[model samples]
Target: MSTKTLGIALLGVGPGSEPHLQSLATLADSVDLRWALARSNPDKARAAVPPSTRVTADLQEILADPLVEAVIVATPAYTHLEIAAAALAAGKHTLVEKPLDVTLARAEELVGRATAHGVHLGVVLQHRFRPGAQRLKQLLDSGALGAVQSAVLQVPWWRSQEGYYAKAGRGTLARDGGGVLLTQAIHAIDLFRSLVRVRAVVASQIATTAIHTMETEDFASALLTLGNGAPGVLVATTAMYPGRAEVLELVCRHATATLEGGTLRVQYHDGRSEAVEGEAKSGSGDSIMDFSPDAHIALHRDFFGAVAEGRPPTVTGEEALATHRLIEQIVRQGKERAA
Candidate 1:
């Protein structure tokens, strides 16, 4: 694994690209940093990667390079399909940032293109790669927790009004697609859904809290139905003061599991206990990219391995659609209630 290296390019070098950059930094040996397309800050992008890597402003140049076997599209949500379409059409493996795109339709199209071109497509939903998350997933899959009776997923986070949401197109439908759920809690939503399959949104409420004025909701609360016909609740908000870690609590027949931040603790009814601490950070506060790069690194490794083996990545385009569809359902239900 250490000696196997794949030619990779980073497109849309921006603040959002930091995690991916950090992952590539640790994966230097596993990947050849072929190109960094700055398009905006060429000098900054050049300084961020190794001097051996080429810095370019043109997408065509990166697409034309046969050695660039994979392209990581770290661009804005709306630009995802356009950029990723080119890469996939060129027969290069592509990994796009989360939420897939501004719209689920666009995301579906992007995934369709990858399939049409016979290329690997993955989304940057890194939560399932976290150690704690992995443990919980295994427990549920092995039936060690028995059947899930109930669950609660909460993301009580904070994003300063002046410094965060006020940024250009920060919480707008045109830019980020939606608010906290899409931009911030998507990771948490994806992670929880992977561990506990959420079957439906029973009821929901969405709102733009007094904490900030934005086009999208800064808070959302919903009642959910789990796959086992169990009940669950989802509460996500970026208006909380002095942010804290997100949490997911599950009450299973044999055991109960509590996941907060990067830690997971499970208590079996028989007095046995289990815990797996994760290093992945929770960007629940002001800075969205404040988490550790462990999950990101894992995603990179899995993606590269999947490409080499001609297998679908763990969080493939189709797998990611589950989250996107779930988010859309939450938003639509919430808004309809308001209307």
Candidate 2:
């Protein structure tokens, strides 16, 4: 393993930035959390960041710092491309929070820029780092599950009207990118796609509830065809009451596996069954802040290790663009059907 300590900067001081902050704090040996840039009020920035870290309003301050080897763009979705591109151009390894960008074209452009700059570009799809997810992936890779026949993914998460959507840019198309599917369920979506290659998607979306007035859909369901000729269904929504655990069920020729919350259950054709408990916590149902930071810590560890070893991170910018492309397809097909 490489043994280099990297200096990092974090952009954006919002709630989304919290997990990154918390994760980086534990890696004092591998990383130095150098600076923070928050476009919000100075008071809020000060309160959100560590006392030892310098807080700035200008993005240039971070880019100009020679000691800053990497940057984490935790800003709004719309700002991802600009900030991440700038960081890559400045010779910093860049890691942007999920959804990569609102559109596939911009996400692809960011990936291209990173390649030209020879810098590492990572995306925060932390679900891939979860213990249960790791075990499931190993089983699939080992061919123990045989030929996968079908899969089902459900993200029945909840966000209160007053607590979530009422925020300035919570559900706005210009900032958050898209509702339910993009903002809330993208983790499960990315995890599912990581395990199975998606060939096509036929989807429908709507913002039917009156809970919060948003410009995007609160619910979406998609019929997917996998590369291996398996059929899959995805149902994602923020309209479900009391939000339940996100679930992904995979059915194979020899065995079937179900991942609910952090638990993994697998049943074989030979009358054998196994259950593995994972790091489960209340999902975004009760509060959007209910998630554990364990995955983030693992993601950061891998990212820093990749940077030190001069290899691509586990979730690269190009790989993340695939998820954004799928999201675009779902939204486009939904619009075409609606029209």
Q: Which candidate is the best by lDDT?
A: 1
Off by over 4 Å in 2: 202-207
Candidate 1, pairs of clashing residues: none
For model 2, residues 1-339, the per-residue Cα lDDT tens digits are: 467778899998887888888888788777888899987786888887778789988999889999999999998889998999889999999989988877677778889999999999999999888888888999999999898999999988788888788878878878878888788888888899999979998565555477657888888888999878789998888888877889999999999999987789999999998887886663566466567888999999999888888888999987888888888788878878888
lDDT (tens digit, per residue) of candidate 1 on 67-116: 99999999899899999998988888999998899988997898899889
Per TM-score, the best of the predicted structures is: 1
Worst 10 residues of 1 by lDDT: 278-287
Model 2 clash pairs are none
Q: Give the TM-score of each candidate.
A: 0.98, 0.96
Candidate 1 residue spans exceeding 4 A from truth: none
Listed per model in order, the count of residue pairs whose N, CA or C atoms clash below 3 Å is: 0, 0
Candidate RMSDs in Å, in order, are 1.2, 1.5
